[model samples]
Target chain A: MGDHDAPFDEPIDDPLAESLRRSLEPDPTLVPSAERVAAVRRAAERRAAEHDRNQNGPDSLRNAVSSRSLRPLIAAAALIVVGMFAALGLDRGPDGDVEYDGDIAGPGGDGTLRVVEIGIGRLVDLDTSDLAILPTGEYYELWFVGPDDTPDAPNRISAGTFHPDADGRSQVSFTAAVNPELLPTVEITAEPGDGDPRPSGVVVMSATIDR
Target chain B: MGGSSSRAARLDPTTLRQVVERARHHDPDAWESLYRHCYPALYAYAGRRLSPAVADDAVSDALARAIERIDRFEWRGAGFDAWMYGILRNVVKERYRHVTTQALPTDPAQLAQGLVEGEDASTALLARTEAAQIRRAFAALSESDQDLLELRVIAGLSAVETGQLLGKEAGAVRMAQARALDRLRAALRGGLDG
Candidate 1:
């Protein structure tokens, strides 16, 4: 037979209830460790990425990434460069292919913009002008930040490095391991040209690849 | 159910909604905030019901599951932590079934147990002995009694929240909780008498 000594109406503050709470309480120190939180957060982020991939096919994902990265930037800087840059960035060539354009904003953002055709993924007909010539020995490296938005190496893929000419203008483009359309954001970092593998904290410019 | 409210009720509902919205958008900062807010209580609940190692796994798996199914989650006033506990309850139940059917260990707590942290010899020994006694007595109760106690004390849920999770009215949960507590008290006394 079970003891029914206590009133059923009040279970919160009774002696037995307090004892149960205390007996079952876990060690205070281990309840919410940072390591556990980090592990769970990483797992959640992985699931989020997987969910994104499943919802949008790889082809559509390219456009999705492009739109996601660009929407905010364009909304913020919509009319800032209305007449400054002649190329509207959305202009299509005679071949009926639309051109993708974006603003490189940071240290030397003055009149600096990039135009490329990322339809098939890689940079095709990459064009950029009005770049600030860096001091000798410092070059600019291009990077594509994936949808993860983490600065970690796996998500930050380096496209390549290039040097500007005496006129502060140069254009040398090539294929990259990751599709710009898929990653959708371009980050230009000022590197010391010493062949360091990781991106330097000196990010000079960031641009959104508007599809 | 009318006796007390959940810890989640202390958090502002508007802020929780905003955090949930941000988390659903996959905002890292917002997600981290949500994780930190819910992890400790959920961990304690899992650790109490299962071993620490299994608790860790269940909490991680539950968080991942919650993230995947976040879009389907609607704010029904039960709060986010309650929703998370709901997922964790199912995960722990599944794990409990698997672990119970396995070979019994020298420590019966492994049958479905409480987590004890290691400490200095004398203090650790004393705490462990008491915790073990309570745990054993807790295990002796009927499944429903054990579950009600676990949901109320281990999960630290209020009568209302427990009622929501268990699909019982607050008044019913309180009545059930009182009965479960009486049994637990008797078990503890029985340990003392023995």
Candidate 2:
């Protein structure tokens, strides 16, 4: 069969195909409700605002001060504030709690994984927007892997197991008794229900802990 | 293809790409336009496999995820509709994992609407019967077959566009679609015989 280059090529002349098409035709009147559309728009706007804030954070302030004809005192004061914020580690959760954050991505999905040391153990918070849903009898497992980890001789500790919601968005928090300094790599894998306590090696997402 | 009012069908690829670009820059109007364009097909795809209520939530969730991940979206010439459908498909599959039973809408009158041009009573009745038959036959096919046909007939995606969403070669998709149609026809015949 020769593939057509056109994006939406019309179907061939077949009565069955035509009838199937008519039967499955989308109902024109079945539009999304205005409220639903508004909700989506609100979500988009919120994400946009967050993105803008991230993009225009400390670097943007430094650039604005240096590029403009500002007074020396104001520029120096702005720089000092930026420096203080950076030095204080504003992203840390609380006093004596070291936080590590990184992006986890692989084919068909991506997410953010955050680890925080809460004195007793580590807390992992995973937020994925587009992870594929595993079939029944299978689930996704999170692992904190050490530097010497390998496929054959895997050196890792399980944080938890979870399945994404119907929306393929998973926001989960799990507490594990491990240290981020020892297990600096985080991994997510699709594991079968075989009861085998081993890394399946089917890594869907992985990232190094960025301190 | 004949009577589809899907906004995606109305938008040319160039205009759609422009709108997607604007949405990438976080333009509210652009996102609105994109949502309207893709909503019809996305709803149809989800509604076919899910209950009406779940379908609505699935579409909303797909759009929400699209907004969050729009920054990472790259243009590959399949247009934004395919991209939105890709997300919706994943959402639908996730829903399927949780659901042991699907609530497919099989109302003959509802399925028959707009299938025929004339408003005549007899024609409408015939349309309803035929539509019911088609729906039954369509449902009897394997899930993979139904998915292919849904992409081709319902979503109005070309083989190439379906391939892009499914991560398959265009020729392979075309061949598979033909095979799927054959299976559907066989299923229809089996239904009639039964």
Candidate 3:
């Protein structure tokens, strides 16, 4: 037996305590199944990401970049821009697709945001890394912020809401009926599930739409 | 004697601290390693008190809660294991409350039978009578005594760690555990005689 099984300040030879300990030992077959372990792992990864976000906030990527030399930041941006072009080249639907791409950064992390006009509605694609997973009853909202918007009372159109994957990365696409040029700025906010249509004002990621 | 293979070896304090630090930063591998190390003990504690299905649910719930609130966990004398026990304790109590109301098995015989049911046929056959008797005596113990013994034996917590989780001094935990053992002995003897 490990030292943990040794009696507390008493001799280890106590037969009654020994008997109780032996009886209480869990059945070897009582181990968690593979599915259960996977489920737990998924939950842990998500919680870890959420905890990271809560501790660092939406500016985690910026803060990390700001503290280090500009080389890594420049490299990360270059990589993202290259990735955006590569994706757009393959993903370009037809003539007059009207694609606008820019950078989104906040507590969750930094990534490229692409808005493509697909005749009926605008398709918003967000590819971000180090995004935090929100707790249940909370969600991340995407918005089109107008130029004349104030911090307190902003005029914005809601695109949709999404939660990031357990790995703190989001590569999600949402379609909304809004003109990107009219709104100018794209923003993401962490919203509570209070059934309110208004933004929670907790901006997670934001970027200007390249016209 | 029957099911020793499932028991997880405790991590040393230094390694545990490092793992916890990495886990706090949202490291998936770190979180996986930590959970794997802690799962056995947590499951043992829950499994003894609850049915197999309920025990699994309770451990899962406790782990989810732990993940949700891991940022707020601070390193102290009791370490992360004890902190996890504290969380599991709450989950078990909540489950016990619900299960009791539903009239699920809460008696010594039922608990003993549950243990036996978990073992394979050969192990069950070899240790059924003695194990069941011991379990019955243990189940007959006061709630506090049961908790103390479970922490010390099933969860493999040291006296100091058990005390920390139970909100008592180490010396006091030792004293209480000794008295609990005496009561268990009397109960066991009575069972054998009767």
Candidate 4:
């Protein structure tokens, strides 16, 4: 409890005393996604390499060396990394989609849509924390390259894309009500950040509720 | 405040903050420990709010994100539990778009995730009843109250981060959260009685 001194409308000091705290709690175990980490590392390394090239090139290098400055670029890269991660942590509201902001490629689709075959193994993982959920606020958005549909398909303009965390792991399965495990759920394709609510991409991933 | 030293129980704020610090360093032990510590609670919270698969996805995704940002593990005298819990809440919210399409998600995933596994009808019924009660109680509160409760009880966020999520100061949140809880307690009590 805290000092109930500051605000006239402060919360009660003993807020949930009568309520039952979880007694026999389940273990908070996370299923690790190793494949994702590798992909993230690879991507990060690639970017780092490209950065190295750009900095060492005759023109940029001369500009930096002549003026004797490297901190700015370092700061810039740091900022970029922070920004990239910050993007990862974001779950954009209904209208934050940037159309073609940073979507690398389509997730899964046929030629008509340019679908990418996505799987748990396909995502890039970079977190050293061994956490199942990546640090990114969301997973990467996927696209159906063929005949697609978004969340509210026929209605919404675009298919819904489930973005991955920094490690690119997103939940695509739904739970059953009665049997909990008896019925299976469907999987939908990931949509781009197009600022649409309804999922408007082709159904790339799906599975019936596994009984 | 959480009362009674619960080991794997609701990780009091201090332990939670330490877990964040450990998880940040890629400490597999700490990572696993923290993951194991919060995942199920998150699962339950997500379950209450979403479908099973979506809940798992949210919990799993949250943990993955937690891994990446371990480097940003700012203790700030806050419990890692609340911080991580806050992340889980976002995961649930973000995944909602697709989850909405799924017809009936909670029951199946709840069973699958071993929430209310094979047991007597009474046991399952009781658990379901309690869950339903909680959900009903949760819905009765204001959106802000619901958010705070979910963050505190379900998400297990710290006072500071909880404030950050809702764009308020920790002290203000602490006060608001306590009041919110009082209101919730009243609501739950009334629901239980009336």
Q: Pick the candidate with the highest TM-score.
A: 2
Residues B1-194, model 1: lDDT tens digits: 00111322222556667888988867666666676556656676665556666677778777777777687566543457767776676666644535532121326455334545455554755666666677768877876677667767766666666555554556776888888888888988997898
Question: What TM value does chain A in model 2 reach?
Answer: 0.59
TM-score, chain A only, candidate 3, equals: 0.53
CA shift of B153, model 2, Å:
2.7
lDDT of 4 at B160: 52
Ranking by DockQ: 2, 3, 1, 4
Q: Which run of 10 residues does model 4 chain B get worst, by summed lDDT?
A: B1-10
Model 4, span B14-107: residue lDDT tens: 6655655654445555555565456556666666566666666676677766665555555443345555665676666556634652333236
Docking class of 2: acceptable
Q: Lowest summed lDDT over 10 consecutive residues: which window, candidate 1 chain B? A: B1-10
Docking category of candidate 3: incorrect
**Candidate 3 structure quality by residue, lDDT tens digits, B1-194:** 11233533445667777888987776766766666667667776776677667777778777777777676676544567767777777677644535631223435454455454545844665566677778778878777788888876656677776665554556766888888888988998998998
Candidate 1 CAPRI assessment class: incorrect
lDDT of 4 by residue, A33-75 (tens): 4443343334434444655576579777667755737777778
Clashing pairs in 2: none
Give the DockQ (2 decimals) of all models: 0.10, 0.30, 0.15, 0.07
> What TM-score, to 2 decimals, does candidate 2 have?
0.60
Alpha-carbon runs more than 4 Å astray in model 2: A1-14, A61-211, B1-10, B100-119
Cα lDDT, model 1, residue A90: 36
TM-score of chain A of each: 0.45, 0.59, 0.53, 0.21
Give the 10-residue window scoring lowest on summed lDDT in candidate 3 chain B: B1-10
Off by over 4 Å in 3: A1-13, A28-30, A55-211, B1-17, B100-127
